[model samples]
Target chain A: MLETLPLSLDAVRDVAKECFDDGWRLVTMSANQIDDAHFDVIYHYDKDLTMKHYRLTVPKETVVPSISPVYFAALLVENEIRDQFGICFSDIVLDFGGALYLEEEVRAMPFCKVSVAQKQS
Target chain B: MARTILPFGPQHPVLPEPLHLKLTIENETVVEALPTLGYVHRGLEKLCEIRDFNQMIQIVERVCGICSCLHALCYCEGVEQIMGVEVPRRAKYLRTIWGELHRMHSHLLWLGLFADAFGFESLFMQFWRIRERIMDIMEATCGNRVVVSVNVIGGVRRDLSPEQCQWIEEQLAISEKELKQLSDTILSDYTVKKRTVGVGVLTKEQAYQLGAAGPTLRGSGWAQDVRQTGYAAFGELGFEPIVEYGCDSYARSAVRFRETLQSIDLVRLAIARMPAGETAADVAGAMEDDTPKPVSAGERRDIMQAYNRDKRHRFVTAPPPNLDLPAGHVAAKVKGKPDGEAVTRVEQPRGELLYYIKGNGSKNMERVRIRTPTFANIPPLLAMLPGCELADVPVIVLSIDPCISCTER
Candidate 1:
């Protein structure tokens, strides 16, 4: 049977806190936008030996907090979402500015093309 | 000491593709290095939105010339998860056999190039020559030197005949002997050791923290490998990740050299345990009894309209009888849908490559993103290079086997 570890909405920060304070090495954080209300955040953590995958979901505007200080990799992933999609991090300060993929003239922030007028513009 | 920034590539003798990295050097030591990417951006993720799942199989194979099997396997595993299709054991073994062969060739090919970079022409030729032998075997089986488009949605595209199977065993046996000797030579060679030892060390803590998988993390005393996850026939045969602990350039080289032996062993094990049955998975033909019916008429008409409105890629009927797909997501999230999304990780020759597929529920996918191993490994390179001398950069980079094309793809 397929297994999954479900966490409550309020437990998001605590989950990151346990992993960050523990010996688990924070590997990655992939925030997948399911829809306007559903956003799945897949937290990838590993130690010297084993790796763990933790998934948490929140509403579109719901800020579940950032694991930046706990796991540095999460910071980059969060920034990628900000740059690619327009998902705002509550207080995380990540320096991800620069032309990583798209050109300068074609909208600086994420979700630029997602808008119809901007896409046609 | 004075510091200066020297640009290394996008165009350099050591690197093949366009990977421009500027290194800040103080005397002979590099203080800081900044790497800029995306010169070879093909927007592959965007391309997938247009191509259907079946055609995307062929396109994903082109993601990287080497270790294409892993990409296809990851894609298949993702698709299989969505479609809820279980590949037969025979096909799993075939996946293992070809996957290991690809690993052996990729490592050896990287080894040859590394030797050439160090001006060791003879060693370079020796390794490349052995790699070519394996490449020839791969060509005979998969009909391609680099990108072998063998993977399909349900299972494999080509089934190996008895003669072809026997040929693979024979080729691996010879390659095994040559690789063993090469490993010995590489380990003991005074110059190879002198150049590689104590250069570019990624500590155990550093490796773990940075999320370096496969040989990179393994070289740093961590034996973690995704193969143990048993994606294919890996579970059938006892497959352990080849690991080393020294955590330096020599340790990295030794780890790869040892892995070559491991890959050959795996291929041998796979061939010996190979079962005789239909290697082909039926694919589209298997849909009749599949839990989810192929795509439904109503859904197809709606999705077709969505595709037409996009003015990009749309699914077309193959003719004869057009099957309807069941409502809700038919396959696993990896195969993608118009509504769901998936992130699949596969252990490539270098390390772990992650594929994130987001579906919008239409016939065509919405967005397909990839986070390659090389992109992840580059940060560690920043950490690894600072302590090492300028001369060792080429070998260190080569040891990681940075396929800039794979990263940019």
Candidate 2:
């Protein structure tokens, strides 16, 4: 019956903490850059007792904050967000570069990139 | 001081889709699994901007081939939420019919892959053969083999005749017999039990919290099914998520196999109870010149609400021959002017799928991001792999039914 609809960036950690504490493991983190100025990242939670959704937004060009320290699943989704969108996580376990599936050419397209998307300056 | 980094698949033999994962394995155990995705982001959100709401279903279906109809289902549901259109009752039942049919085939396909994972050629071959019957039913009812184009904004594009319904029932009957045999063998077979049982156990508690969706979560003793949302015409119909509590690979297989049988029953029920009604809505395009107008939020909500009524639908909402999806919704300036952004989540076949759509109300979307199930479920996979022998990786991974395309798409 509880729907998070859309959560704020400041509340991202609190929601993740509560969801994880409440026994809902973080499944995946989905993100997309709205434009050059803003980015939206969604943390998907999976718990038997609860079925709901939550999200957070960050500045598109800002340095990456590590959610992986709190949730491991966050790392995979982060890597994907970085690759497609070119947003870089400041410090983490892996570099998470290269086209996991896409090719060099496809990666160059604006639409082909993702949340932590990177474009040549 | 020593860790082996192994790159597994973008196009490996075991994997059907192209997901490149780099696993830091120590002594055959995964220390860390780094997944590299985004090979499949086809700019669907941007495509949404260029393509009118009507053509979006065909585009959305291509997002995930395995769950093509469901992709359309989620998109329609999302749009319908914005618009407030009410679809007819008959269209809802028919949508359920195709949706269940898609679930059965997808699970059957995964079952075959699981069997193949352990090199059980006979079981693999047998399971796949039965899947063909379901595909035949799909072709008979919808025409296309995989993309089924059954979802339109207002309702389905076609309806089932009495004879077609009877034929579908008969084929489902045949599929049930084979699926039952398959489940029996999977449950009692020593080889399968030896390989799958107790392997990759994701406790019910774990399944729910992880935001896992579909059979993967359900197989682990947790009930997380999207059909319960009753999108399309599911509100009038009755269906349950096929579940198992064994929390192992075997149980996962059983959940899918059993669900295949359930789908047959559901299809029979839908066909038997179907009421006659108009399959397509009148959607005609009335655009004389390239005139652009800002669509009001109220209009957007109405359009999405209308779509909600058409959820899980297999028909297309054709704007009365001349008038297409109002150019108002298309050329209209949105609230954000590319300032506002939103994320969309749906229960995909594998698990929870997230699509982040950000628009600038421009010709192209500002950004589009997706969170696929495999990427999210990878953590549990690493947790399941540490103690198991390297041989079990294939089966355990297969249990999740990772469609790297969805992850990348």
**TM-score for each of the candidates:** 0.82, 0.78
- Give the true-contact fraction for every prediction, in order: 0.22, 0.53
Model 2 accuracy (lDDT, Cα)? 0.65
lDDT score, candidate 1, position B52? 68
lDDT of 1: 0.70
Please compute and give the TM-score of the first chain of candidate 1 against the native first chain: 0.68
lDDT of 1 by residue, B11-81 (tens): 87878778777788888888877767768867565566557666677777888888898888888767666
What's model 1's lDDT at B53? 64
**Top lDDT hit:** 1
lDDT of 2 by residue, B78-149 (tens): 444333345566777877888888888887888888888888889889988998888877876777777898
| Model 1 chain A poorest ten-residue lDDT run | A112-121
